[model samples]
Target: MSLLIVGATGTLGRQIARRALDEGHQVRCLVRSSKRAAFLKEWGAQLVPGDLCDPASLPPALEGVTAIIDAATARPTDSLSIRQVDWQGKVALIQAAKAAGVERFIFLSILDAEKYPQVPLMEIKRCTELFLAESGLNYTILRPCGFMQGLIGQYAVPILDKQAVWVTQQSAPIAYMDTQDVAKFAVRALSVPETEKNSFPIVGTKAWTAEEIIRLCERLSGQEAKVTRLPMNLLRTARRVARFFQWGWNLADRLAFAEVLATDKPLNASMETVYPVFGLNPEETTTLEAYLQDYFSRILKKLKELDYQATKTKNQKKKTSLRF
Candidate 1:
């Protein structure tokens, strides 16, 4: 059976494609350009060039595909709004997929999307979920929590680099799941009979707060890390100023994300119920510490390589100057 992975160029989408390919499944990618998705082609993924925003471009991408994993998302910097890509685009894809006689349609949504309708991103996701449910195709919705990659990049990396981790407010504990783990669950959902027509909240085993994360960073990196908290009023003012200027990107999205973090709420669901459906164990999920370690290790390796290159370049310049 062939699978079509929408948003095949995204971080999560790419991971899903790689996982499906490794499992010996025939994978196809619906990409805007085959040039940008050359890596997917190298991984043996059939590339179908199309755009989610353009409905006319979808049918060709959905052709001959048995299932579709909808992971496409709108860029905050793009002229496209959340309504366009998250809702309209997805609805268009669902319609196209249904007409194409696709059997299963899998959607990647945000965790607690319905509960936080005030947030534009969540509202868009909620609407898309509804549209997919009524699309008459066998559907599975996977709502994953905040990714470990996101937290590591936003919070942990700064600490490792001896910079402060900034926050709008003290956040509650969040169970940040690894994108790889979520990808594994998504691929399993396509084949698992019990997962059909159901929505699963996928998350990691442990929950962590901003303070705990900072402390962990100090422990792991052996460096004193500072935490800077910004007031909600200040954030709101900044958002307003950004909106007035018609900024390069969507500042409202950033503010909404910050609001979600500031409000003390649990972003994770019980993993006990989720792991069994995919025949996965809690221990198998990547933890915050594990993610931090791997992330910093890579950063250090890259810095070392840069240093070596700089030193080699200096030696070459010195030799040339001496000859002159």
Candidate 2:
């Protein structure tokens, strides 16, 4: 079957494409620039030029495709409005999907998006979920709490580099699942009849707080983290400043997610109902500890190798100078 993956170059979307390709499915990626997504093409995915912001460019991309997995979200640094891509553009994509007679529509939404209607990105996701549900198309909505891939840059690399790791009033515990695991469900959803028209919350095995993550990184990297805790008022003021400019709307929408930090609740859900339907094993899921350990091991090993090479070169230079 031919699978069209939206946001094929994104963190989650790329994993979905990889998994689908590995399963021997014909994979087509809806991308804005084939030049940038050339790596995916090398990985055996067909790239179709398309943009979520451009309604006219969607239908052609969906032609002859069996299903769609939309893992696309507007980035904080994006030039376009989140609403334009997440809501309006998605609406156009859905309408076009229905018109194209695509078999399944898999949507990746944020957990508890409905609770934060004030947050532009979350609200857009919540609305898009509702739209997909009522669109009369065979659909599966996967609400993932967060992605662990974000931690490498957010905490791990920064700790290794001795940079400031930012935190906040941080009350919410998040079960940040690996994007690869989430991708498995998205790819399997197309073949599973039971998953049609259903929504499931996909999260990590355990939830973690900011302090816990910082400590984990410190232990793994054997380095004390430089922690920087920003006040809620400061973030709010920054968000307000961001809203004043058209280019800043993306950052403003993303900063609104800080509301999660103030909430008492954890952004997580039980997989008891989720894994069975997808025919996936919970034990096989990647844990936060294992993920971090692997990252640190590979990185530390590379650093040690580089240091050895440098020391060897310095010693050789000294021996030659002393002989001369």
The prediction achieving the highest lDDT against the true structure is: 2
Q: What TM-score, computed on C-alpha atoms, does each candidate reach?
A: 0.90, 0.99
Question: What TM-score would candidate 1 get against the native?
Answer: 0.90
For candidate 2, write residues 1-324 as lDDT tens digits: 999999989999999999999999999999998898999999999999999888899989998998999999888888988998899989999999999999899999999899988888888999999999999999999999889999999999889999998888765899999999999999999999999999999899999998999999999999999999988899999999999999999899889889877786899898998888889999999999999999999999999999999999999999999999
In model 2, the Cα lDDT at residue 92 comes to: 95
Q: Return model 2's CA RMSD, one decimal.
A: 0.8
Tens digit of lDDT per residue, candidate 1, span 1-324? 799999889979999999999998899999888888999999999998888899999998877899999888987776766667877888889999999999998899988888877788888898889888887999999998778877776776787677878976758678888889989999999889899999999877777887888888778776788788888888877777776655423656657766677678878788777788888777878888888888777877888899999999999999999999
Runs in model 1 deviating more than 4 A are 245-249, 301-324
